[model samples]
Target: MNNFKPYYAVIFTSTQATDIKGYLVMAEKMENLAKQQKGYLGMDSARNEVGITISYWESLEAIKNWKANTAHLFAQQKGREQWYNWYNVRICKVEREYEFTLE
Candidate 1:
């Protein structure tokens, strides 16, 4: 499935702390929870020296709801307290998208 309509994208960029023991588990949990949310459309993630995760949403309200979710709030706290050294979140309207694939 794909979204061709106008939507919202939450871009999360971060650098990890040296001690991130439970971070991966919590991240996976959050991903699953996000999939179950009201306006969740899709997500893409990659990590190298810097981690970037873009979560697609149907609307700004949906994004706000996710940010306010209990479990997500806990994750956010954990991220600040233990997992991330620095992070930035940007919410933008995605008005257009295009891709090329080689199969």
Candidate 2:
């Protein structure tokens, strides 16, 4: 789904702590829960020494709702307490996009 119109992107960038117990499980759970939320468009993520996750939504209100979700709040706390060494979140409006693919 190529969404070209205006939308919201929640960009989460982080560096993980060494002892990442249950981190992957919680990450997966959060992704699954995000899929069930209203206005959720899509998500992309990758991790190496640093991790980046960008979730797309239809509106700012949608993003705010996701941020305030109870389960996500727990995950945020866990990330601060144990999982992440440091993290940053940026919410932006995507006004336009372009892509190319070979298949």
Candidate 3:
């Protein structure tokens, strides 16, 4: 979670195709590349029948830059051609957030 207020979240929901050939490697690569990008805050992801990845950013412009990144573009093309059977991406401004911890 990010401490800063008014951050942006890119919520990526995906369902993997049966043939996941290079999915894991590409996913890891993208995550590492995203971490090296400007305005990148953090990311949390989970996978089961459906996969959900939420990545936090400092601004919408940063998100745009990430979307336009060459490597990411190639990954996106591959996702359309192979990896993902279905996917949806949503970008939102996070104004307020709260969480609880159990010990």
* RMSD for each of the candidates: 2.3, 2.2, 2.4
Where does model 2 exceed 4 Å of error? 1-3
What is the Cα-based TM-score of model 2?
0.95
lDDT of 1: 0.97
Query: How would the candidate models be sorted by TM-score, starting from the highest?
Result: 1, 2, 3
Tens-digit lDDT string for candidate 3 (42-67): 99999999999999999999999999
Model 2 clash pairs?
A: none
**Weakest 10 consecutive residues of candidate 3 by summed lDDT:** 1-10
Ranking by lDDT: 1, 3, 2
Candidate 2: RMSD to truth:
2.2
Q: How many angstroms is residue 94 displaced in model 2 relative to the true structure, after the best TM-score fit?
A: 0.4
Poorest lDDT segment (10 consecutive residues) of candidate 1: 1-10
Q: What TM-score should be assigned to candidate 1?
A: 0.95
Checking candidate 3 for backbone clashes, the offending pairs are none
Model 1 pairs whose backbones collide: none
Error of 1 at 41 (Å): 0.3
